[model samples]
Target chain A: MMKGADPDAPRLWREGDRLHVDVRGLCCPEPLVAVLRLIDGGEAGDGLVAHVSQEPLLLYPELNARGWRYRLVAPRGDDEVALEMSRPRA
Target chain B: MTLFLASARSRLLPASVPFRFFAIAAALHVALWVALIFAAGEFTQFRGGVGHALGAAHLLTVGVLTMTAVGAAMQLLPVATTRPLAAVWPTKTVFCLLAPGALALIFGMFAAHVGAMIAGATACAAGLLLFAGLLADNLRRASSMPLVRAYGWAAFVALVLLLALGFALALDNSLGFLADHAGLALVHMILGAFGFMGLLALGLSHVLVPMFALSSAPKGRVAWAGFALAAATVAAAIIGALLGLPSVLAGACGLGFAAALLHLWLMRATLKSGMRKRLGLSFVLVRVAWAALALTPLFGLAALAGWGPGGTLFGLVALGGWLMTFLFAILQRIAPFLASMHVSRTGGGPALLSDFSAAAPLKVHACCHFAALAGLALAIVLDNAPLAALAACVGLAGALAFGLFLAGIVKTLASGKI
Candidate 1:
């Protein structure tokens, strides 16, 4: 799990075989930073989904460099944008 | 955790490349003022020939604007496109060729040496053509940022036209083959200033302004229309000038005004709604530049009307008031920002932007810059050489102050001090 430095940091949760980060209402670099934190925390297995209002373009290069792949996940409910990323199982 | 974490660094270039270009630009900034100071006597009456006025004009055009454009574009283009430049050597080579080439061209213009001018022009064209090639390749790959890409493409086209006309103008100096030397020269200036560098600056503003201000980026539809209008304006202006159509040229100015208005509205609205309540003194300079941009078309109209000193007013406002002012404002912010980004790449914690920035020098610069602009405008109105010379000194002081600000950033980076 990613640690939060602020009380208002994005909420994080886990659902079967996936970690979901809700970065709604947060600005750019914040969502990207949250995703990075998840990756650095070793919690990013094969299924990490980030919900953000803005497209996390900055994260794409980092994700690719780390052997991770991502695709946009159409919003369900109030999520403006959801990006799903994973490293393929060996 | 420290306040700053090293951000993702995939597309970022080795810091040295952009820094070298910037350093050269800063040095040339001082050189430009020095040239202006020397040419002040001839400044008002200078209708363009091989002299200090002409040399100084080239120094600012090639030396400062184009030099900074290349450097900033190389670094920022990748960021906008989310892809790294395919190769680096071409970029470094551009700097190598352009830096000396600008100096030689300026010197040649000063001395009226045809051989030196030819060699310098050849070198500059080679450097610019290579840069255009690199820009085209990168822009081609950028499918995501549509508005930015569109602006880039338009700017690229304008650059090609400018280069073609620029070469013709240079050759005409010696060969005397062309009948309409003045006509072609007018086209060359219009394309270089409003077409190439102008578009590039406008495009980059779309990216940089929102990012720095922490504002939402402008809506796509409005920005797209603005870009279209700007491109149309450039086309109309070039065609009008080439065909000797004054009314069509005025129409182009009208289009330019519409585009400028739209751009300013978007920027102003963004700034107003920004998360940042106080965007610092840099925005003050930016606002001033916007005002100057708004006046440029009006000044162009005045020039067309055969008003007193209209040509001089138009040139000063367009080049010095709008472009130069806006560039310095953005560069003030970008230099430290890039420095911080680079410092974070190293092992240590990233330097705070506030620590690296020295406010006093920026304040000094702002005051002096505005004074120089006003004084020069007044000098033209009065046809006073000494006043123009004095204004150049003020402008030079402002440039030096900016240099000190840059030096402060370097010192902060070197010492690794808070």
Candidate 2:
């Protein structure tokens, strides 16, 4: 069924002090909602991806505020989004 | 299938409407704020770097304020119109061009390099053009909500006018269109603040504050006064600039803004009075912003009344005192709310909204935010750099911690099926 989202090719890639979450191809409540969960778990303050397709692109700031360094990466394909997040001091 | 297609079409054209630009713009806002703190540090109180000040102002206006308004409008348009944006490219285009351009301009200003500034401003203008085109297309079909609708109309017109003025200013700095500078400066400030940000803030706050604070909607007559006053001020200011009048128009514009703020104050007090009990950080933000708004026109009136150093402090009051403080509070709540909303929930998942990171951090942030803002206002009025920076750094701490809050929320979400 599901390919488990490419472990080696993390749709969400994380290096020390950075976390990226790809919520692309999704819509409003979804993008914001997902990011909130991460912040609730204390993943904010550096860079983090709340990546999604164009649908949720405008609502990315919720990611930045919680401390996940926020970067919006829209892959050319309609299906993929890369949210690149980093912490300020790691 | 047909129903789905119709809904999609309604939202896509001219970009999704309830105004989502605020989202993108918000990031830009903070980025600029951070940049300014670092960049402005090099210059002493009277270092006299005209370009530096101008560039920083642009970052605040274009990068921070406009971006947020744009995003917010797009997001809210659907709620207002039951429709979506036409094309997606416009939003992407605006951001893609703007982010880098703003960087370049700010860099140019710091380095005293006109060429970089010109190049950067051009990119920003291109981004703004796309924004205008998309806004115009949306305005033709945007909702019938009077306040929101009028803003759409004004935003389109203002976007075009602002871009043209920005370009001229950029060139003038290089080739010297010195005489036009003062007039254009007035026009630019009027359009940037009063036209775009002011209108958007006035209109959106009607929906936003109520939603966040659980207050009742604004009464019609009061809102109309605000709308009319904001419109009159912009119009008068624009005309005044053209004719070189006795700054009376600007003074009158100040009065108009006061009228608008007063109406909002009435609406706010109504909300506060009706509250069964005080609530979260978001509501705290709602309350604090009013204080900032109160200062805005007080300073405006002081300017009108010819109080000394009123001009200097007014900027502090409006930009730092009002907009920044208000925005931070909203962000704290929205950040968590939006994050939780975006989580891919399982049917059996814990309700994420209820499980947010503790209110303690928010309370801490609030204290820091207010202190920083107070310090900044004092620093500006007193012209104290160290004081301003110290205050800003604290605000930055709260802001940075606010940024950190995202992670806490994520952990809560992923920790379990919740």
The TM-score values for the models, in the order shown, are 0.83, 0.70
* Candidate 2 ranges beyond 4 A from true positions: A1-90, B1-49, B214-216, B269-279, B304-308, B356-361, B406-418
Q: How many pairs of residues collide in model 1? A: 0
lDDT of 1 by residue, B91-179 (tens): 99998888888888888898888777877887888899989998999999775567778889899998988888887778888998888
Write down the RMSD of all candidates, one decimal each.
7.9, 13.7
**Mind giving the per-residue lDDT tens digits that candidate 1 earns over A1-90?**
334676337788888879899876553334555677677668776679888654454555456436566776555554366788887566
Q: What total of clashing residue pairs does each candidate reach?
A: 0, 112
What are the candidates' interface root-mean-square deviations?
A: 11.5, 13.9
Tens-place lDDT per residue, model 2, A3-86, is: 266321224456666676665432223344455546565655444555554434333333333333434344546444454555
- Residue A57 CA error for candidate 1 (Å)? 10
User: What DockQ does each listed candidate score?
Assistant: 0.06, 0.02
Show the colliding residue pairs in model 1: none
Candidate 2 local accuracy as lDDT? Answer: 0.59
Where is model 2 chain B poorest over a 10-residue stretch in terms of lDDT? B1-10
